[model samples]
Target: MGNMSKELLREYIKEQNFTNANDILNGLKEMFRDVLQEALEAEMDEALGYRKYDGIEKTNNNSRNGYSKKTVKTELGPVQVNIPRDRNGEFEPRIVPKYQ
Candidate 1:
């Protein structure tokens, strides 16, 4: 997980204007889903040895193919997340396993 600055958190909460318990829970779920998605993207970048859209330092031919939608069951409920895929089919996500 990454550190979210207080200013950014405050700004996000203000934008949300959470007024009830259910609203707060829903907001948390959204945050969790977003963080998980970002982590998956970062993992792909690391595995492929270059960030997406940057062909400067790319040494291999493997590249980003597309995304596969997977429903992750969390304590909050089921959240739909897009798992990044590589062209060579060697990108196995560790955050949410392919078989999980």
Candidate 2:
């Protein structure tokens, strides 16, 4: 997946004739999922004050906890995302608010 390029994506779309609205929506959903996941991870890093596997000694009591599955409604459709968590449960995400 890391090796996939825009040209390959375009070729796949053309080969599959993904021109219909449903196909476009599905594609957008997938793209949004990837983006949202990355954002959530980044948010976690910022909240924890360290990157994943940074190997730095813990300076604070709060740390990253496992993620929680959440389904959000969007214009594309219902997209499932993994929301990051903190041990102190104080890491509120600004990208997708907890109540939203």
Candidate 3:
């Protein structure tokens, strides 16, 4: 029904000693990291004004054009993402690291 807050979830797990919760969280974290990485890479590719997809680089299939390497700044530090680009000479790489 309603979204469970992080604090609530933490407290519930702590009280129950539910190790499963940690596993689930770890799994989710992995999934999120992968998805986030792909998204950020795509964005970075676009920002770099990429025009085509190169085997050397990770480019989104949705991108019709190519892409270029970009350096993105993040809270953790500098992250490089491959932004997507359009065939119409449009590409904007993002300034974020590609998550695992």
Q: In model 3, where is the ten-residue run with the lowest total lDDT?
A: 91-100
C-alpha TM-score for every candidate: 0.91, 0.77, 0.34
Across 1-93, the per-residue lDDT of candidate 3 in tens digits comes to 158698986775566554676776654454455565687555645554463346555444444554555555544445444454455554433
Candidate 1 colliding pairs:
none
Worst 10 residues of 2 by lDDT: 10-19
Query: Which is superior by TM-score, 2 or 3?
Result: 2
Tens digits of per-residue lDDT, candidate 1, 1-100, equal 2588889989998999999999989999999999899999999999999888885967889999999999999999999999999999999899999998
C-alpha local distance difference test of each model: 0.93, 0.87, 0.52
Clashing residue pairs, candidate 2?
none
The reply for model 1, stretches above 4 Å from the true place, is none
lDDT of 2 by residue, 73-99 (tens): 988879999999998999999888889
Tell me which of candidates 1 and 3 scores higher on lDDT: 1
Candidate 1 least-lDDT 10 residues: 1-10
